[model samples]
Target: MASTSSYSSSPCAACKFLRRKCMPDCIFAPYFPPEEPQKFANVHKIFGASNVSKLLNEVPPHQREDAVNSLAYEAEARIKDPVYGCVGAISVLQRQVMRLQKELDATNADLFRYTCNEMPTTQPAGAGIRRINEAAAGASSYPQSSVYYYNPSPWNNDLCGDGYQRGGDNNM
Candidate 1:
């Protein structure tokens, strides 16, 4: 007796799941190789086989690989964290970013304070007296108009004009 049986190589994950022969030109062959059945299994379990098929069919060939990878990652995340999934991961990352930003702001403020404290307070000869005299003369001449006096300080600039003050009794 002679047997006329034929054997073919294993089908891709999709065809294996569907219990059909995998064609050479099947769309799922490239992404879902027969060796990695778990990848397709996860995707199929999360998103149904029919939905996966429809998605693969709708997307262009060039984009199908990325779509498959994205689907697989999302599926795995959903499996691990059923309640929040990727959103939970995103929330954690956002919190980390906010914390880092606050730390950075504090560091910058500290550096500014240190640098301001380290700066010299002494002015050139006659600079301070001349500025005081000029301010007095300007204040006397412009009694009705607001007069501004200049002072060299890192924290506060002596801006006294329009009823506003920097280091005076005015509201500003």
Candidate 2:
């Protein structure tokens, strides 16, 4: 909001553009100071002075500043893109957010894979042996090496030389 005291000597942007005397109680004076002539020009060009005054008068004083700023921003956006304006900017931002979200999900999946790979293979008695389910861990996110076919029985020496258990259940 512009200071009315500062605009006392010179006419406000609205008054200056309209070529009218800027009264002390001018409604546009507080929002449109003499320093920013283009601000009022764009707003007035988009929404007429009469309509703006009526709107400002009808709106609550506490909300007048927000209304004025919104009008200015919308007016500038409309000038830039007459078809979509602020909606175009919002659409572009929304698309960027969606793209970033997908990228984040892929990165998280890779991190989960790396963390699981680096984990210690040994587990406590109650915890049981870690085994990958073909239905669950066979997704592309989990590499083929993650699939386990081990029988963690102490008496069973059926494991291969490289410590990889095999033979019984095979899901190709």
In order, candidate lDDTs are 0.63, 0.72
Task: List the RMSD of every prediction in angstroms.
Answer: 15.4, 13.7
Q: 74, model 1: CA deviation in Å?
A: 1.0
TM-score of 1: 0.60
Candidate 1 residue-wise lDDT, 56-107, digit = tens: 9999978998999998888888898888878888899999988876565555
Candidate 2 residue lDDT tens string, 5-115? 555579999999999999988999999988889999999989989999999999999899999999999999989988898899899999998887656555544443444
lDDT, residue 19, candidate 1: 83
Best by lDDT: 2
Which stretches in model 2 have alpha-carbon errors above 4 Å?
6-8, 123-172
- The deviation in Å at residue 159 for candidate 2 is 30
Model 1: lDDT to the true structure: 0.63
